[model samples]
Target: MHTVAVLAFDGISPFHLSVPTLVFGRIGAGRNNGDPGGPYEVEVCAEHPGTLRTPAGFDIQVRHGLEIFETADTIVIPSWISGTGISPELHAALHRAHARGARVAGLCLGAWAVAASGLADGRELTTHWSSADALARAYPAVRVRADTLWSDLGDVITSAGVAAALDCCLHLVRHDLGSRAATDLARALVTAPHRSGSQAQYIPVAVPDAADDDPIERAMLWARTHLGDAIDLDGWAAVALMSRRTFTRHFRERTGTSPQQWLLLQRADRARLLLETTADTVDRIATDTGFGTAVSLRHHFHRILGTSPAAHRALFRREDRVG
Candidate 1:
């Protein structure tokens, strides 16, 4: 069996630690799957072995120490403490692991630790979108990709946040076990079968401040209410009583995204709400949300959420049924 050593630390998120375990645990001995790499073993190790406390106010028992990284075929840092200096012992272990051809993965904030190991220098990776700035600042050589859910560069891998970590591990399964097995695993886990590593992370919406006299706010409100209508940039700018260029700049400055991108996100959000609450057909929801057709809605849905509209509905609908 190929051991996959997952590095744990104090204040680790339980959810992050469990993601790889759940995904790789299913891939025991790729014999049935026709892989010659034998079984995949998941081991949770820490800098200081034993019980570790999580931010969720719970403690976990870990039996292995950093020494496991030596024999492990893959090493995963499942989220790290932001702003905390990585210990020399851990850094040396990671460097040795990478030097011996063991794949290293960082999920969410764990990317910082991977970057600190000098493994990600000049390589683009992602972490939680909120911490992208800090990751870039701390490791100037590591290119921080805030947009992607994960970046799988063979030996070195990184994922965005909690949920994206699952996707990243699934990618590993697909790489090792093949697509057919990955699809079955995803279906068993009730997740998207294959979300591309390049799929963009969902951008959090920025609500405009409610101000009666603010033209930009008013224009945004107007555009939101009239999502079914074609929202032209010039027309939207005209509603704000500003020129197109000025409106584009100000809109980006306000929301940190272009008007078109904001509008698309708004439409997708609306579609999600409708899908979750009502039994609207994909075509109807698409039309109502200004996507024009089911295909367009599915396109944007995959682009943002990395899943199809029907699949998304099934998830929420299944939850409601279970509830």
Candidate 2:
């Protein structure tokens, strides 16, 4: 059995901690379909063996210390306290584990700790987008990609944020086991077992108070339903009875992105859903989503999603059909 160790540090997010435990810690008795059913032995090792406080004001008791790392086949660093300095001993242990060929995982804020360990040098990485600026400033040598959900560089995997940690863990399971096993596990966990790691993080849509009210909300809903139509900025502004400039400003404030970008994203998302759930050809999906051509759809999917439309479809395609 592969031994998995999670570094339970102070101020860790409870959800971040639970992600790995739920994914790898709780191994069912069923065959991992083809992979070893020996299952992963999960141990939560902390700097000190005792109860630790979370950022949510909750407490969790950890019985093992850093010594548990000696047997770890993979070491996971969940969310970490940014300003808190890492101890020399813990650093040495992580360094030693990496030196001996143990896979290292840094989820969310935990990327800072992995970066601090000097293991991620010359490698691509990601963290919570909110901390991208700080992480870039702190570790200039590491290539910080704010666009990706996670970066899996074979041995070291870094995930973006709270929910994205699940994506990273699923990637690990898929890589360590197989796609079928990962899918079964994901079914058990009620998540997309094999979602592409490159999918964009779904930033919440924020609309201004006036826009959040009745008429503008109705207009926005209309626009969403009619993405394939010629709904330009001026057209939307007309729907809202505002000047194009005012509408653009208000829309940007509400959506945290330009109107055109948001529209494109929604259309691409729509196309993706259709490709996954329906048997539509790429060209048909393109026309349906206002992209006009399969080339345009592939271009946008690759540009925004970091993967081709066909690849995206293959990942989420219905189970009954063969890719």
Candidate 3:
């Protein structure tokens, strides 16, 4: 089993701590006939083995210390206490773990600690949207992605705030375990199995004015069902009953992305689902997802997900057998 060590510190949010623990801790619990014996063994560690105060007005007793990092395959920093600096010892420990080829994850404000450890230097990182500006200002060497739900740089991963932490942890599980296992776990947890990290951090959620038909919603619904076909700005504009220019402006305002970008994202999502759940050929899957050709699919798939379709399928296949 891969050993996972979670680093806890004072003033950490209970939710942030729980996200990784719950996701990784429950790895082996099969849901929907999933294979058993999860690959991870998780332990919570601290700078000192003792009670740590939380922002929620409670103390959590941790029995393991940073020494656990030596044996861990993954070290997770759930959240950081604002204004609390990492001691030289802890910083060294983090660097040592990375040097030994252990993966490091910083969820939410925990990005601060990861950044301070210098592992995030010259890498893309993301934190809670509210603190993104501050993180960028504090660590200019790190490319701070404020809009993404998470940023995964193989060894170093960072996530946006609160519920986005769940997305990040689930992503880790998906990366290690497989889509089937991850989907089962997500169903058990009552969450979506795969929310693309590239999605906007904050989306307006007000109910559409019921009396007026929401053109964007209508257009989106139309787009979802017709992803197999070639979709363009003019087609979507016609569906929304607006001119192309008007539709483009409204699309940006409502979705925070251009029409073409949104369509690409949706197509990419469909391609990923097909790649994970089916045995379809890459060419066939590409056509099914409206990419027209395997080369086009590969281009966008790699650009958006940083992995090839074949490699992604191979990971799921490998994990399915292991699980």
Candidate 4:
């Protein structure tokens, strides 16, 4: 079984500490593109293996120590409290684990430790938007984007504030197991499903709009079910039974992106899954995803994923691939 070690500290938010535990715990059985990666064993470890007090006026017990890092396949540092520094022992252990390619993630303010540990230098990352400036100033070599929901570099990952942690963790499951597993997990958890990491962290509308409109939901479902069909913003607006201007406004407020960009991302994501799970040629996958041509597919893949379709398939579908 793959072992995941989650770090906990005194004063850690109970909710923050619970996020990883929740996501990985209930991923009962998962598969990687029809191949099982086996079940995960998630354990929480701390500097002191005992009771730790939370700001929520409660205590949580941790039984494992940082020694677990030696055997853990992944190390997750949950959202951290301000003003804490990584201890020398943890610093050395983190470096050692990273040297061996153990996946490391720092959720929300926990990114400070990952950054301070030197893993995030020269990498693009993000944190809670409120602390973005501090993180940027402290780690000038790390590119911090406060607007993004998460930044994932396969092995090293960081997520934005509190709620975005769910998205990042779900993304991890999707990358590790596959789309079906992640979607089912999301359904079981009752969380929003498959919001790409590149999506904006927060919507720009001044006041939140009622986004539960049935027509908009129906239109989005239609678009998702018909990715191969050529459709435009106007067509989507018509499907929603609204004018183009109104649809655009509502869609932006609801999804934090323009209709065209959302559609493009959906297509790219569909193409990516097909690449991982199928033996189809690039041309077939592109047409099946509404890209129309392999050239168009490659262009979007390069812009959105920083890799070509062949590279993505090789990386995702091969035996000795990234975790």
Candidate 5:
């Protein structure tokens, strides 16, 4: 079995700590009748393995130390804490692991530690967009793409944020095993299995209106159905039987964005689905999805999804053939 080691450290976020375990721990389990066993053997390791306090107000006992780095096919570094640095021993072990062609992954702020080890030199990567500037400034040689959810630069991979780490891990599973296995794992995890690393992470969940007005729920349903049309704020306000200003205020109180922006986001989401699962041409997709033109679609696609329609289609199409 392929071994994947996660480097856990003090003050590591519980969310990041859980991502790799959930992804790799179930590697060989048969989630469905047709599913194949997992190819991965995952372990959580640290510089000094033992009872380490987690940021979640809990502690975990880890048995393996940096010595596990020698046997790992992939070394995973989840998000790191601010002001935390890897010791020389840990750094040298990581370097040696990389020298043996082990894949190294730096999820979120873990990119900082990977950069410090000189593993990401001259590599194109991403971290949390909030820290992308500092990461770029500190290592000019690393080609940092601030918009990406994650990037795999051959031996080194990096993810943009905590949630994006799931995307990266799913990608690794898809790469090593197959899309079917990854999809099965995703279903078990109750998350999308193969979100592109270039997809946007800024979706705002729908919030219920505090006023508890019945019209607000109807408005949301209408917006979801009518996303394929030009949905103006005044139009939705009319549909809701409310004045535009009241609608605007209520909309934020209900959905956290103006109707216009919400409509744009809905359209962008529609366009993403089309690009992912349909063979529709970009121009036709743009018109069919209310984006009006290919250029308009391209604009929103990049602004919302952080990648072009063509690229999304290509990536998904490639994955479709992965079996």
Candidate 6:
């Protein structure tokens, strides 16, 4: 089983601390459907092996200390109360974990700690959008992607604020297990199964009430279910009972992206899942995911994910077999 160590500290947000634990800790828990459990062992560790006071004013006792990183397959810095700096001991420990081939992740402001370890130098990273500028100025060596929900570079991962932590952790599940397992976990959590890391951090306009019969949301839902079909703006507008121009404006307002861009991201994400889980040929997968042809799929897939479909499938297959 993969051993995951989540680092905690005093003054940490309780919600932030719970993100990793809630997601990874429930990996192997029994499901009602008799589905096999996940293959992860998760633990919460801290600098001191004792109670750490949270910003919520409660003390959470941690039995393991930073030394847990010595045997951890993955090390996660959930979030740091102060995004300013990292203690020397913690910094050295992080470096050591990375040197030992442990996958390290920094969620939200914890990117500062990952940067402090020097692991993010010359690498693309992201943090809460509000702090993106500060992080960039503090660590010029790291490429800060303020717009993305999260940035995953295999060994090192960082996410934007709050709920983006769920996206990042779910991504880790998908990486370690498979798309189906991730989907199952998401269903259990009552969350969207997949939200691309490339998605915008926040929408510029206020979100309409979800309970309302919002045409944009209805159109999006329809589009998701019809990704295999050749969907156009006019077709989506019809489904939403709106004119093309009106639909376009509402789509951008609600999602912070144009209809075409959002469709492309969804298609790319679907293609990735097929690539990882099925033995279908690239051309066939492309057609199934609305990419039309292998060349078109390759272009957009690489542009969005920074890797080729074949390479991604091969890597996941190899890891799945090994696991």
Which candidate leads the pack in lDDT? Answer: 6
Query: Candidate 5's residue-wise lDDT over 140-166, tens digit each?
Result: 877777777888776899998877899
Clashes of each: 1, 1, 0, 0, 2, 0
Residues 113-133, model 2: lDDT tens digits? 888887888887888888878
* Alpha-carbon RMSD of each model: 10.3, 6.7, 2.7, 4.1, 6.6, 3.0
Model 3: per-residue Cα lDDT over 189-303, one tens digit each: 9997777787778877554776258998889889989998988789889999999999998887777778898889889878877877788999999989899999999999999
Enumerate residue pairs that collide in model 4: none
lDDT of 6: 0.86
- List runs of model 6 lying over 4 Å from the truth: 29-37, 210-212, 241-246, 276-279, 310-323
Highest TM-score: which candidate?
3
lDDT of 4 by residue, 75-113 (tens): 999887653568898899999898898999999998889
Global fold similarity of model 1 (TM-score)? 0.62
Better of 1 and 3 by TM-score: 3
lDDT against the true structure, per candidate, is 0.82, 0.77, 0.85, 0.84, 0.79, 0.86
Window of ten residues with lowest summed lDDT in model 5: 199-208
What would the TM-scores of all predictions be? Answer: 0.62, 0.62, 0.88, 0.83, 0.63, 0.87
Off by over 4 Å in 3: 32-36, 203-213, 321-323
Q: Which residue pairs in candidate 6 collide?
A: none
RMSD of 2: 6.7
Give me the runs in candidate 4 sitting further than 4 Å from their true place.
Answer: 28-37, 206-219, 237-250, 274-282, 302-323
Residue-wise C-alpha lDDT for candidate 6, range 1-323, written one tens digit per residue: 78899999877889998898888887855344534555778889999878888878679899999889999999989997545788899988888888899999999998888887889999889899888888888889998888888888989999987889999999999877767668878998899888878778988877677635777778888898999899988988999999999989888877767899999989988998898777999999999999999999999999987789998898789645644
Candidate 4 weakest lDDT stretch, 10 residues: 28-37
Better of 1 and 3 by lDDT: 3
TM-score of 6: 0.87
Tens-digit lDDT string for candidate 1 (56-75): 88899999999999999989
